[model samples]
Target: MKALVYNAPYDVSIENVPDARIEQPNDALVQITTTNICGSDLHMYEGRTAVERGKILGHENMGIVEETGPGVTRVQPGDRVSVPFNIACGTCRNCLSGWTAFCLRVNPVEGMDGAAYGYANMGPYDGGQAELLRVPHADVNLLELPPGTEHESDFTMLSDIFPTGWHGTELAGQQAGDSVAVFGAGPVGLMAAHSAMLRGASRVFVVDKEADRLALAESIGATPVDFTQGDPVEQILEATGGRGADCGVEAVGYQAHDQSGQEHPELVLDNLVKAVRTTGGIGVVGVYVPEDPEAADEGARHGRVAFDYGTFFTKGQRMGTGQCPVLRYNRGLRDLVIAGRARPSFLVSHELGLDEAPDAYRHFDKRDEGWTKVLLHPGQ
Candidate 1:
């Protein structure tokens, strides 16, 4: 099998790997058709996370189930399915409660609570960035898509960004007619803005310095707030008549940068705190780890940044932070795609083959022009 393997910082390659097969009775073997190089993959690609060498590097995945174990009842061979990144056991306490992201029975690591494919410290599961993927708890995690490849690009998003973006809005408690200010114009950020629009936000502001991403945000009916022009919070406030936005979403995560392009771990958090109304809610869907050995800020190296907790407390704002439980939102989001109410494929800027994944990773990691999102067809 050919798959993208992470060797070191900024080094990934397509190499022949062992074939993926069913490892458990509840498992299914999927022939990966479409997978995306997600923003989260950059964390490992940039050496910001402890993603081990030789690990397959993709999570946003969808494909045809080539085979399934007898224990898998819902998903069957030849069924097109989208597998969520979080690999949860169906009977776990957290999974039963709809908190699939925090499933207690998946991660083998003693202290870890959840599991994911092809991620650092998440689990031992191989990812879908290859010709085939072995999916455990198949019935619990596989989302059956329409039989063919119609909306292939859109259905591929059901695995991650689309639902996670909607999770940002859910955490922020966004209501129809309320205004939203989203920090970062990456794929997730753009989706957050788009989700806000679908839910009827009166105004949506996307903050980013990248001309390409900001333009994409604007194309989605969001007001673009380029940080290089001025303080993003200030720009958002002015647009909201100085009252601040009714809600805010932080999609940039820990490796966030300032206006001058210097890395600032707390930049987005501070901006979100200041950009929303005093009593408004904020949702943080950005990835933040306990430590980053390559962090530009010394404090961030130890996962300690000077967050404005005092200001946050004074403002009486509420915040929700964590990974998105894809099960909670994907079904509805998938229906939105089928009904033509959502088209997340609009964010995909490149469609490359599995062999070209390394270069795609390089360009996407640098935040290069017109590289908002890159979808990889593994079998191509």
Candidate 2:
């Protein structure tokens, strides 16, 4: 099998690896057709996380089930499915309550409640970036796609960013006719803007410095705010008639940067607090770890940011932050794709074979021009 393996900081390679096979009674073996290189993967690629070398580096995955364990009854060979990045056992208390991201039974680390494929500190599960992948708790974790579903590129997003983007809007309590200010125009942030528009937002403002990304956001009818030109908060406020947006979304996470391109761990949080109206809600879908040994400051190294909690409290604003539980939203989002209401593939800027994954990682990691998103087709 050929797969992308993390070698070191800013380095990854396509190397021959052992074939993935079902290791548990409830597992299924999937022949991966499409996988993605996520922005979160860049955290590990940049040496910001403690991910081990030789680990396969993909999480957004979808494919056809090649085989199933004896215990798997819901799906069988030849069935197409999308594997959520969060691997959950259906019997856990959190899973039963619709919080699959916090499932208590997946992570091997004691006291850790969540797990993700190819993610640092998540679990021992290998990702689906290769020709094959093993899916644990197959019946519960694999979303069976509609028969003959041909939108592989679009459906592939259901595994992570699509649902995650929808979750952001849901967390912000966005209502029809409301205005939303989303910080960051990365794939997830763009998806958040698309979700906001799909849900009837009166106005959507997407903030970022990249001209291409901002243009993509504007293509979807979102007002683009290039922070490099001026204060993003002021720009958003000006667009919102000075009342501030009805809601704000933080999609840039811990790697947020200021106008000068310096890493400011709390930049998005502070910007969201000031950009959202009083009593409005804020949803954060960005990845923020408890520790980043490569952080620019001692406080951020421990995952502590100097946020404006005093101002947030005074404004009576509410905030929701965490990983998105794909199970809670993937099905509905998938239907939206099936019905042609959404087209997430528009974010995919590059489609490469499995062999090109290493170079793709480097290009995407640099946030290079025309590299908004990269989708890897293992079967290509």
Report the error of model 1 at residue 316, Å. 0.3
lDDT of 1 by residue, 1-380 (tens): 99999999999998999999888899999999999999999999988898889999888999999998889899899999999999999787889999999999889877778899999989888888999999999999999999988999999999999999999999999999999999988999999998999999999999999999999999988999988888888888888889999999999999888866788888899988998999999999999887789887788888787889999999999999999999999999999999999999888899999999998988998888999999999777
Q: Can you list the residue pairs that collide in candidate 2?
A: none
How many residue pairs collide in each prediction? Answer: 0, 0
- How would you encode candidate 2's per-residue C-alpha lDDT over 1-380 as one tens digit per residue? 99888899998899899999888899999999899999999999999999999999899999999999999999999999999999999898999999999999889877678899988889998888899999999999999897664998899999999999988999999999999999989999999999999999999999999999999999989999998899999998888789999998889999988877789899899999999999999999999988999888999999899999999999999999999999999999889999999988888899899999988888888789999999999988
Candidate 2 residues lying further than 4 Å off, grouped into runs, are none
Candidate 1 deviant stretches above 4 angstroms = none
Q: TM-score, each model? A: 0.98, 0.99
Worst-scoring 10-residue span by lDDT in model 2? 144-153
